[model samples]
Target: MKKYRAVVIDGKKLIRRGIAVMTLAVVAALGVLDIKIAAPKINVMPDSIGQSAVAESVPVIGAVSGTAEKLKSSAIAVVKKVVSFVLTFDPFDLHTAVAEELPLIKAVGYGYLARTANQSIAAYNPQNVDTGGGTAEPATPGTGQYPITEVDSGQGKALGKEKSKILIRNETDFGINIDEMLSSPLKFDMKGEEPKVLIVHTHTTECYSPEGASVYSADKSDRSLNADENMTAVGKAVKRVFEKKGIKVIHDATVHDNPSFNGSYENSRKTVEKYKAKYPGIAVVLDLHRDAFIYDDGSKAKFVTEIDGKKTAQLMLVVGTNGGGLDHPNWRENMKLALKLQNHISKKYPSLMRGVNLRKERFNGHVALGSMIIEVGSSGNTLSEAVRGAELAAAEISDFLNTLK
Candidate 1:
């Protein structure tokens, strides 16, 4: 009986291999025949209007495992290019060939063509595709999702262009005591037993490019508020990090800058007020956002660094002042918190942060002493890098908060 079972399994394996060979033969035949084809023209142009300019180049170094991946990717890309090039040759139209060719071959070829056409149509639909940076499947709206597990904590060495520049400007109503903030001890008393961190985004629609991705769809922008796509996804990363560190956090994934870009701050302010009223113990309010700085040449400033052999986006701390007659006196206190956290992050993960920016306008910093806007990365940084920056920021923040009395 055991021998009989082995014989049966061998027979099945032979049959499966035969089918695979037959499928390959059919595909080869289709390619040789060139039933139908379309010639596509390629064109490249400079951006006339000012848009976020992508970095001309970046240093992409991977570990030993990355070599294998690069080879496999290269082979696959070459095959795809060859196939695409062949499909452009119209040796014979499908209908014409079917009408004038061998009866059996024609029928089989027509059936294959029909099936391929249907599959192509379904796959090409814009609404069905998931263009997010990572392999995690997108979550259905209204349902919470935490798909990312491992953080990219690789310590990347500084390349020539990878270092982010720190710009200091005079944009404050009063003199900033940077020396005092740097010297101040990290100490905070727990206000209440509930969650003390409130994570929010004024421009919830701000998004980053997918890692190693180049294509963009007509219907969707790289900057979206989709839960698993943009800054909301980054917020989710931060929330998970804080939760893991035993820090209670509430991430508001509400889209305030949707449908229109105006008055987003007003909408986000309401969200902060509502959350503050509910959770009086909230001591830290981080308005997480990604920056988009287009250079005069229309290229975006790339703030990238390699950590532990992984490429991660560097972070920028933007502490606002109560200038422009905004009536925000507690701005100095907020700056103190920002400077302290910045110092901590710089000490621990030096490559993970750019310098701190002290902006002039009050960007909803009056909500809390610990409130400040953090730009994880710019438009040039991929979503993967942005999320890694968020994770590192969460770690530094948790360390600072735990030190408080």
Candidate 2:
């Protein structure tokens, strides 16, 4: 009898070891696949303190990496749908479906089932999912595609080499006011030690795509809130340009979108207000953000154009109006500044500026008449492109602001 018990114990031990080995093998396979979620990174600049440095690239994973990521995402979506359907039945409301301890058992069973389902779903779906662009809006030319309302067709210097016109589609229902904003020649007097321009980022974590990398992040949501590595790096580039031009700028490298995505605008507003209070000479408050343009066919849209023999990402000027139930009366002033800068950029860089975008949100533009949001580039662009774009923008903006009288 003792010999028989020992044999049974040995058999049980062998089964346990086999199960452990299988579990380890599955984990090893997943590690090899290196599946990533499909979140694209957005770019933005932050605070300053140096010359614009060239960006370095990291090698991207093989094609299998992306495929595994998509497969896992689809399986989760399917399981979520099934779970939602089961929850709608509300079995708890029916006494027929309940027993003495069935409620507790059902809760425990559902928890375990979800955990098991998540673990068992293999990252190998045969179906092809459009993971690239997803449902991102395309960079469709014409005014309706962007958030803008051209109030006035400002004077242009008769189009430089290969003149670019601001494309606008007047079919939208947005109100347009053609106010003569150019009252006097814009000029700025060199003030005391106070900063001339204040730069801040609401989405301080937005980062550009790395060169030679398939995606910016291994996870689907491609964003890094690192102030030194992401948007703040771009901001520093801009600050370097301004400093080179002898324009004093205050680049606030605060990460507003850190713990929460919401209330970023509010946080940035406080930052702007604080700086404005400290530096009364701050003439312009720039909220720097990077734009994202993804094509409808799940492909990233490229907004790069050759400027001065360097591949530079296009820059967009976003000016907000008080149309969206916001009490911003000085939006026209901001628009005027935007128009002037747009005209200057179009003339200087030709195709570098993607025209000025007018939006309904205040975007904290009420902070100052010179306040505006500058979108450097999209996720499809590299850090080098964005940094170069910011430098070019800073030069143009410095020239324009200096002429403010």
Candidate 3:
């Protein structure tokens, strides 16, 4: 009997060990398989941080000694740091790790210049990428396969090569700016009784700005701050909104102070997951965020609305375009929703938007069909304006979800 017991124990240990290996292997696989990490944009645009979401021939970071050595000295060192930042599987704290290594981003300046010079040389070489003719125009709205309003014809010099570098740097340095970059891109009208959809107010940008905790109002502690951590508050707010509607909501608003980048999303993703586990019936998941586009003069973008004149915030729809396994369809469906919302707000409230942006990237939108992101205002914008915008957007969202079938 004792021998049998010992054997059982040994078998259990092996199983546990195997589980550990498999778990790690899966994470690495996800990383290689392009497990998308939606980097927060400074201007409300959701950037794609890890193009590598799944495992591939690429060596597991810090796996072999030689690989570690190579990473310790390669340009990919930044890549590894970013991966570590997104994965959060490390001895180093994500924020502190990135903060401590701000130099890495600054160093990229030289690389950028060198690359720009090279590109210039290539352009002159005549065999390179064709800058030929005038720029192509965007397809008319509702003209595409989808039934949505048209995006502005504004294209071209706005997305120049140099601007691309700045954008890349911004994505690496900060995740995504919830307020400024992504103009509201949701469409739906919930004028009356409808199922209550929830928008989780998360901490994308660090709460404490240079001024104070105005736009920085969050509840982050020693523990990580994501939308989940503040589910209590989220639940309460959602409950408050849905009290009369006979609807219960799962809110994931963790007012933790962090930069509105990947960290915020990371924290929020876990929180939403936990909430979903608790309440499986959840249909819509809205990530309510503010932006951070401070002008050189310190003023933020503002829009005059029926409520009052406030800093204008941009809203974006971050949908998972990855149709790969685990990736969801109808990701573009959110685009339709976003456009409707943006148009409604524009008609009812002018200057409340820079415009809605369509990011090819996904910011966890694949989790559900009702998933979408909304950015209010930027760092230069007042917290009061942002709060007002949040409330307004909430109203619009609530109204819109009521219409969702």
| Candidate 1 regions with alpha-carbon error over 4 angstroms | 1-170, 185-188, 214-220
Per-model root-mean-square deviation over C-alphas: 21.7, 24.1, 21.1
CA error at residue 334 for candidate 2, angstroms: 0.4
The candidate maximizing lDDT is 1
Give per-candidate clash totals: 11, 21, 60
Q: How high is each candidate's TM-score?
A: 0.57, 0.57, 0.43
| Alpha carbon lDDT of each predicted model | 0.59, 0.57, 0.39
lDDT of 3 by residue, 1-405 (tens): 010000113565455445545555554654455333333333321333331332123434322223333433332344545545444333134544442233222222333311111111112424322111111111111111221111211111233442211111111112334333235443333333433355575443222122222322111121224323222322344345554444445554464334332234446666777776765556677765443322222222232233454432333333333322223466555555555555455444433444444333345565555676554444333344445555555555555555453
Full ranking by lDDT? 1, 2, 3
Residue-level lDDT tens digits of model 2 in 1-405: 010000113565455446545654554565567666654332212322111121112112221133446455444444434433444322223442341123222322332311111111112313321111111112222222222111112112224333554432121236544234444444345466778789999878766666644432212333575565578989999988888887888889998866665456777888988998888788788878776543322334445767678877777787766654456788777877777777677667666776566765567788887888887777667778888988887998788766652
The deviation in Å at residue 212 for candidate 2 is: 2.9
